[model samples]
Target: MHRFTRILTRVVAPVGAVALAAAFTTASFSPAAADTAPAASGPAQNYLVLYKSGGSAAGASLAAIAQARGAVVQNYAQIGVAVVSSGASGFAARLQAADPSVDSAAATASFGVSLAGDAATDAADPVSPPTPAPGSDNLSGLQWDMNQIHAPEARSISGGSSSVVVGDIDTGLDFTHPDLAPNVDFSRSVSCLGGVPDQTPSAWMDDNGHGTHTAGTIAAAKNGIGIVGVAPNVKLAGIKAGDAAGFFFPEAVVCAFMWASTHGIQVTNNSYFADPWLFNCKNDPAQRAIWESERRAIRFAQQQGTTVVAALGNFADDLAHPTQDLQSPDNTTPVARDVTNACAVVPTEIPGVIGVTADGNKQFKSFYSNYGVGAANVMAPGGDSVLQRTAAAVNGRVLSTWPASRIGSCLRKVFDSGATYCYIQGTSMASPHVAGVAALVVSSGVTSPGAVAAQIMGTADPIACPDTAMYAFFPSVDNGAPQVCQGGTAYNSFSGNGQVNALRAIGG
Candidate 1:
């Protein structure tokens, strides 16, 4: 299935064994080591030209791009990053040399991806679950994830306030779905596929179901239709950072963050990582530009009080103690490279952003969720089909809204009240749960991103790592390395601060 998850694909064997690959959308960019195109003018490729610190206004950089034969796709003057397009050969080298103001000119390759292209065959794995009764929001009973986090109980205290806005920075969301239509803030929604903001409704509509599913988990309306969200009354904005093919290029991601910060969005749920490289290693001169550009954007958003929450990826590897990247430049051929903690999974690993790990109904780390002592900030229900093989857990996957019109996009779908919903799994599914809780905290007057993060971590239900014997049955699918958990009970690699408690998040 074309799942929105970053997991280890068995297709490529790193060091002659199974290894890592993200299952969701991401892009490929090479700034420090640019491609040397032969001297022939061709269709333009977009480049993220980062200006030197304390550089002059965007006008100077814009002029430098022109002198180097690069057309301006966008100029983020606030953060000193610009998206420039050029057909000229060696455009990066020319741009860097053309402008003393430019710190780095990194080129995004022909990045088109079916992100996290997990070739695993789960399309027909289980029988479709029963549909919910009409007009009564009967699906609430099937929402095991909500109950796990006490969202229903929390709603009695605060279902979220209209003043708080949460943006899902993924594929655009389904604006017309009844469960989502009531809360979707179209004015704040925008598409950044072209590296600039386009607020038109059509520009940000969900084609791939990943964004739509994630939005439902965050702020689907509690208007007596389908399942309710953790922060149902909060306004939801669809920030389209990925293209129709589900590729999340640096230009689009940068634009999404800029929009979220500049607009009134108080929180953003990022379920995908920076692409091509599963772990963006700035230590590698070739990938530094991509990492720096995204890092600046994330930092800018944090500065603007936007609580950025991201997935810890689907690969069951430790982020705090990263060792190798076996599935990199995934859009192209796979390569295995030795890595260190200096390499990071974007957005999530970036300081100030809240990184989330996934847990099953049993409250153990999901079989596929990535975890690390310092990398993950919190945990939430993301479902685990393998370990949760019991009647109480149903199919062991999280359910949320899907575009009814794009029925084909969701491999397994449940039609309820003329709406389409689907059951899916991934750290991508888990990140939004924390985002929703963060919105609840924001609604309760915790406006600062730093405070919001602290409240979520502080209020979460602390969970200890499972007994070694309990998890021994499950080993890392990518490598034979034993799935190890480090750190203490209150704060550990597997569960972070622990399963996010919605009721506690709002001081209930």
Candidate 2:
């Protein structure tokens, strides 16, 4: 199986045991650390030179500086981020020294998939259940996740307005899928893979099925073909940030949010963590640039009326109390490193963004979903076959759209519909459900992003912690550590406001 497929299949270990490597020295960066070739060899790596806006003298225009040094391929004045390539040795350090306008200069690093990359093994020890029967919408029965969140009832109140757009900043969307074509807003979609926006719709096609799956869950049309989405009529914008190989570098992440901020997207679902580092430490000098750039973009999006929703991640660990990380810089060399409170996963841990944890069909936290007291803000059905199986929801995994070319074991080919669907699990699947509900709230006249978030949290069903004796982590294949749920019914690490109720989200 491909590494990307494995990522979608396995549950992330919270804090895998490994001896911490030596702390990264703050001395002059090496060629590899800077992600560039040696000055004597190939060209310099691309760098995101951040400029402090509204400063005295407008301090040495980045374009002029870059032209003087090398070539300026992209300029993102919206977020004060510009990408340039220069072969000069120690380019970032040298540029900072020469110009007082640059706030920070760091080489752009590639990020890997945040999910576990083990072979395609179901952690739940799944047993094949009966296929879902086609319901009123032809294939609605295949969508247990939608029914679990009461999407049908919510649809009756407000399926969603075409004017309200949900930006999916992942791999991209299969805009050609019949179920998605009716709701996809091609003009609003863009590929932000190189820290720059490419408005061509086909340029954003999803090679991996992750983005297509997420888009379907958000708004896969109510056109009576495949499964209906949580907000079946809302327009969905594909903000392609992750590439064909499933890597979401910082340049792409920063571009996606900045693109969303100005694009009139009411909400965006961020299912993958920003790449390279699993937990970007705020205090680490090396990781600070990556965190700051992404932070500004997210805050800017929120300020611009884009309600940002992100997954808490698939690692079955407490985000608030992480001790170690065994899988990091996953696109390159893997390392185990000691960490502390100063570190955090981006987008999800960022303030103002709604962080979501995953719940199974049984309404329990999915064995793989990450949770933390302050980290997770809400809960939704992501899926779990081990602890939450039902005859109706075969395999217990969330079913959504998949690209025909994208291969997976649990694929379902629709009869005469010319569309492919699949069953998969992860916090990646859970965040979109919340994104759909957020769209409903916006469609129902909640204009403010903050107000929409407040409404979702306030209207969610309150669920109390399970009895200690009854708390058991399923899937004996995993660590099987004793699971604990913190906080009361109204709010807890396991289930934020409780499970998200789509009907209540629209004031039903």
In order, candidate lDDTs are 0.77, 0.74
TM-score of 1: 0.88
Per residue, candidate 1 scores C-alpha lDDT tens digits across 1-508 of 2224332111122233554444444344343443343345877778877877876325766676676677777767778887777887678777776677877767776422211111111111111121111222657877889989998888877788887788899889989998999988887888888587777899899888888999999987777768988888888989998766667878888988888888768899998877667788887644787888899988988887789999887767788777777656756655666778778888799989899999888899887778888888899988888776446568888889999878886666887888889888888889999999998888887888999999999999999988755556555433445678987879999999888999888888
**Count of backbone clashes, every candidate in sequence:** 9, 2
By TM-score, who's the top model here? Answer: 1
Predicted candidate 2 versus true structure: per-residue lDDT over 243-274, tens digit per residue: 88777878788878877877778799998887
Give the range of the ten consecutive residues with the poorest summed lDDT in model 2: 116-125
Query: Alpha-carbon error at 198 in model 2, in Å?
Result: 1.0
Model 1 pairs in collision: 5-23, 5-24, 6-22, 6-23, 23-116, 24-115, 24-116, 27-275, 276-329
